[model samples]
Target: MKKTIIFIMLVAMNFFISCGNSTNSEITTQKENEIVSNNEENSDKENDEGKEEQIIKIEDNEEDEVVISKSQAYLDRYFQLEKELEDSLAGKYSGTTIDMKEAVSIEYDSWDELLNEIYGVLQEQLSEEEMKAVREEQIQWLTIRDSKAGESANEVEGGTMEPLVYESSLAQSTKERCYELINNYMK
Candidate 1:
């Protein structure tokens, strides 16, 4: 009987130790996952920063015309607005509707102003044929932008975030077009 009791105690102790080790393993796995997730988030943020810092380098062509770099002031303003939006959205879960709307409006105004500046530059610099080509390209770009914006909004259709998403999509598309015009034609 004593031997049986000793055997039972040993089994119970072994089971408890095994359960403790299993719990520790699960905790270790959870911590590792969290660390990996945080690292990936940090890497994404770094990539975004690198993109924001990228300069558009233009070279002179065979015509001997002067090459000009992209406007730093416009890039600065664009990134500033983006940072403001991110700052405003930080730590907020759902009640950022008003803030998001205001940010989108501000971004839209900035994008429109940059686009107008690009248009003015094109008018001053391009020949008639070049202007026509640019106009056709602009029309195509507008079609794409509208389609993309609609699609982005549709992804959140009937949700509270749809308007904000649509406005953000518009702003992003316009900003990208502004950069393209600056890089490709502003020489």
Candidate 2:
């Protein structure tokens, strides 16, 4: 009778230990599965938001394209004329009459203000046709002048003027374009 009780007690203890291990394993597996599912849900949410943002970008870019293209064309035309005007002025007056240093100072609070003032002062003073004609003449003159300069450079010792001198000569043209664009836009 003593051996029988000891055997039964040992058997019950072994069975309970085995069941406890299985239960702990099942709980751990359940926790791991839950964590994995949560991660998957978060990743999917992020992907959806990214796709929406890309769609918005595409839409905005489409609208911007037309405006950007038009502005680019207008600015190109304005800059070309501005360059010609500067080159003409420099050829006639060198560094004497209108100093580049003096023209760069801006008293206006902003570009918009400057433009408004310019337009207010000059819109009625010149006609659009006159502006167009002047721009055409300047472009023509610049083409001729640039061709001559190129020819002269070809005849020189190194086939090109020194970079510094070339840059100085062109600086006025660049400034003229900047001013012209501002003034024209104001108009």
The most accurate candidate by TM-score is 1
What TM-score would every model get versus the actual structure? 0.55, 0.31
How badly does each model clash, as a count of residue pairs?
A: 0, 0
| Top of the candidates by lDDT | 1
Q: Record all residue pairs in model 1 with backbone atoms less than 3 Å apart, i.e. clashing.
A: none
Q: Cα lDDT for residue 93, model 1?
A: 27
Q: Model 1 over residues 1-187: C-alpha lDDT tens digits?
A: 9999999999999999999999999999999999999999999999987765652222324243343333445556557756775676554424478866776777777787878887887787788999999999999999999999999999999998898888889988998998888767765
Which stretches in model 2 have alpha-carbon errors above 4 Å?
Answer: 1-26, 65-138, 141-151, 157-187
Model 1 regions more than 4 Å off = 1-95
The 0-to-1 C-alpha lDDT of every candidate, in the order given, reads 0.79, 0.54
How good is model 2 by TM-score?
A: 0.31
